[model samples]
Target: MTNFLPMTKDDMSKRGWDQLDFLFVSGDAYVDHPSFGPAIICRLLEKSGYKVGIIAQPDWRSTNDFKRLGKPKLGILVSAGNLDSMLNKYTAAKKYRSTDNYSPGGQAGLRPERATIVYCNRIREIWKHTPLIIGGIEGSLRRFAHYDYWSDSVRRSILVDSRADLLIYGMGEKQIKEVAAQLSAGISIENIRDIAGTCYRTETLEHLWDYIEIPSYQDVVNSKKDFANAFKFQYLEQDPIRGKTLAQGHGEQFVVQNQPAMPLTTPEMDEIYDLPYQRTYHPSYTAAGGIPAIQEVKFSIVSHRGCYGSCSFCALYAHQGRIIQARSTESILREAQEIVKMPDFKGYIHDVGGPTANFRQPACEHQMDRGTCRGKQCLFPNACKSLDTSHTEYLQLLREIRKIPGVKKVFVRSGLRYDYLMAANDMEFLRELCEHHVSGQLKVAPEHISPKVTKLMGKAGKETYLKFKKAYEKVNKDLGKEQYLVPYFMSSHPGSGLKEAIEMAEFLRDTGYNPEQVQDFIPTPGSLSTCMYYTGINPLTEEKVYVAKTPHDKRLQRALLQYRNPKNYELVREALVKAGRQDLIGYEAKCLIRPPRNKQNIAVSQPENWNKKRRLAPSRTQHSKTKQTRKI
Candidate 1:
């Protein structure tokens, strides 16, 4: 076992302490989720003989937390996945800033300004010369210039905003390992530009800064002209080669460098999944008194990595890659055995799924050869002809898992790819999956009703969703079970303004299903959808689209998904009014319209108005007195 000193201020002040072999800062909560990308990276660094300490959910109250970790002998590894400061703050801000979600008790509160960026900047301030390497979903997705929904404007690359030494996009296991090894051997961060999966700014590039010249916060505050220019600059993506050339042209500006994308190796993924994780809820946050032992565990395992769905509003494909990589059945079974050995091992194994539970391998055989896939998408309106529909091996693996002792139920709670499901020639495997794995409901993503919006999102059309829904129902009826499909939907995506959103609402109403939850479109960095959100054009096709630019409009589109709520009634009414969509406001227009409220009834109460008048009168008197005193 590798021996390491405990992390503390005292230990950090020691002679050799100036140089930490490794330091891991996670944007996620300390508790390990199956999708804890940062935790896995930290463990990998530990395994490689690095002294690693984690700063989880960093407190930006001061720079002390960053300083306490001490200067790393190598550098800092920052991951903002599973828990991103920006996403966390944005969610909070949305709740607090909205009049509808607000509570009298101040239930929703203001978030700290620029939470993620500020936290990173503070760390840089503390360790002035230390290399700060930013990765994970937040960094990877926002590596380039893109639209920021929270700020309602285009923003600079995350590297510039975070002031990090380097930014790594996509999965960072291999890239980080290489960076650590190189830095430990006395290589400078500047010399490591050739490494794939990294982005950095350099002074040498010419014209590189021309398009990327964003106004400083003060500059924007001081002049509207500077702010507008910065907004335009924010939407641009610099040509990588030209950016490098421009850096060389400009002697003063540092050359911006980017490494090619690096993918994780099979062995590395296997090693990460095999970590000794206590996969229960954090003891402090859980309602249950104690941490549940491994014996009480029923089933747990991740099936694959990455997604190919390419939903425009989704950030998963950006960070995890669109390629699907699965571990062999033998390796997965080994994990199952470990869970079965736990003292409280239950007969049920709760989860065995990944991004899309049904997608076990790459859609095309070219992926095996590391060749470019000519296929536009794995999940088009229908399954790709090249897709391997065979599930014999997968079925056999499930059978083997069931034979294991202490295993009762093996559940697949992850959302399934219905498009892929409907294409299968044989439904036997799917029937078996339902019979053994499903716990009454199978979740799937049928993001929108309109084909136009669906095409923009690179997802299957409404017909596909309906076809799968019908097939699923038939299967359930045949089995004499009441299993249901819980379909996931997204509102206010880049191409989905009020019109498309209303169409989705109408579709939901017609189906007689009011979804319990709906995901609002968050234009995270590095996604194809994010590009559309930023530029108002599809990156691939370069087609212009109607983007919901205003915050209120976006909110209205999101509210349409929750048609059951009366508060949403005002939202729908306002949206229709603003869009001049009077045709949809009537009682029976074949549209999903919210009922109008009496305007007079909603006026401020007499007592509340009187209280406001009383408060303002005193403030006015105080102001008059202060002015008279100053004059005297």
Candidate 2:
């Protein structure tokens, strides 16, 4: 009972099982913790009285590694790990990353690029008749014809490319369990298309009713405008209550996505989190340094799931949906107590929330009966009147966790929606957060300071962040604490041009804070921002937006965010001059960077064989006034 599900045939024989009910293939090293998606799915299947085997990070070059557990009697469940495999391998700049935190020993390149497609193709080679189900972030996001940032082209749905029988979008706990039961009950995978939160390929749409038909696959590839339109249609129908079935043509067959599954109730969420998770990597990985991703969440507790923040660049809406489902208070406190007993528990809880930390309930009561509003967000532009912004329950939960014996400090490492916090009528929660929860510095993602860019990103106005900043400072001052705020900003987001980046640089200069790292926008699939980035038009508004496409322009925009750094000074200067704001290059108090050191500095800063004219009159020389001080 203390052992993990069989990973090898010898272990399988010891379990006295002839054939598994399911074989779960994953792109990440197996860490039997609730935070790992494959772990949660496999445990759910196991608890449902199924013999589930795991094949983690298999060699994709051939089918040998995939056949280790043999084929399951019911089906094959495939996932591209917890993260999108492309994102795992490449940075926003499309450069190969050196380490993969989800792998054993934090090794890179253990999982192949596009792991889901590779795994499914291999399974097809050995077991052609078994049901193939693809899920997780990579498959879910690419369940539709999506723009592949790594390839710079629109690709067909993963269902088509992987040739899997089904793709479970969003969190697949409910969907996967239902599929398993139906399959066990002697239903064919192709016949199990009526379930919610699932996609399947079919040759005919005669049986479907009241579904929205998006543009065909070839149409999206032929026109970026059509792709934008298709995305908008998909975006409006993500809700479980009011969403309709979506059908898109792929050659002779069609990919149909049913309406999203209803969000898990509080008790359902509690039950899932309460399952017997080993809460760590298996003992087999002890020699390989264990999975590095577990270290971040080992002491943390996920109090909830789903986010209503709905930032344009985030895929939470597509993957987790907008409905918030949280574990009960009693359930969370129980987990905290369990953490306190851990041998590695050093009197601190790393994090206490998920997605958005302060969100303990839905945006409003109606979202339970009706789904999240279409074409509108709960907290973007302005907080909706129906938005139930309260902190009483969450504040009480935090207080209770802090009082747990042996738990010295309960920190909230997850990002908190500052605008939501500001919506609360009372400042007591904010006061408590500053005094106890903040660990010297609290990180908040303001993303950008310009109103234009923030609006395009579906974030609150710049004024909201400024207001929260003042309130945070006031609370810290009253508590006699020197806590600081670390605001995260992005560069080269759609609708942000040189002028906007320059304005952001000025904002940073005035605030007197220098950020060491800046995020350049990467157009990940399934986000509204990616739509805008690909089509040059906001999918929601149908208005053209400026996108920094060239490497030179993107580098300039990123440099503006960290203009204080010595290396970025030249890039910042070049950007300022290009934007015709040369005033920002001088030695003035508000200037972002000083004039280049000397003529030699200019030569070194300019690009190779550069012949552009010297922009700001040569670096002004500093003159000693000792001899000229006679004038009163």
lDDT of 1 by residue, 154-252 (tens): 566677778888877667777888888998889988767766556677754443434344455455445444443433332222212122211111123
Error of 2 at 160 (Å): 0.2
| TM-score of every prediction relative to native | 0.77, 0.94
Off by over 4 Å in 1: 1-19, 32-34, 96-116, 205-262, 278-299, 343-345, 368-370, 555-632
lDDT tens string, model 2, 365-427?
999887789889998788899999888999999999998899999998797999998887559
User: For candidate 2, what is the TM-score?
Assistant: 0.94
The stretch of ten residues in a row with the least summed lDDT in candidate 2 is 623-632
Instruction: Name the best candidate (by TM-score).
Output: 2
lDDT of each: 0.62, 0.88
Poorly placed runs, candidate 2 (over 4 Å): 597-632
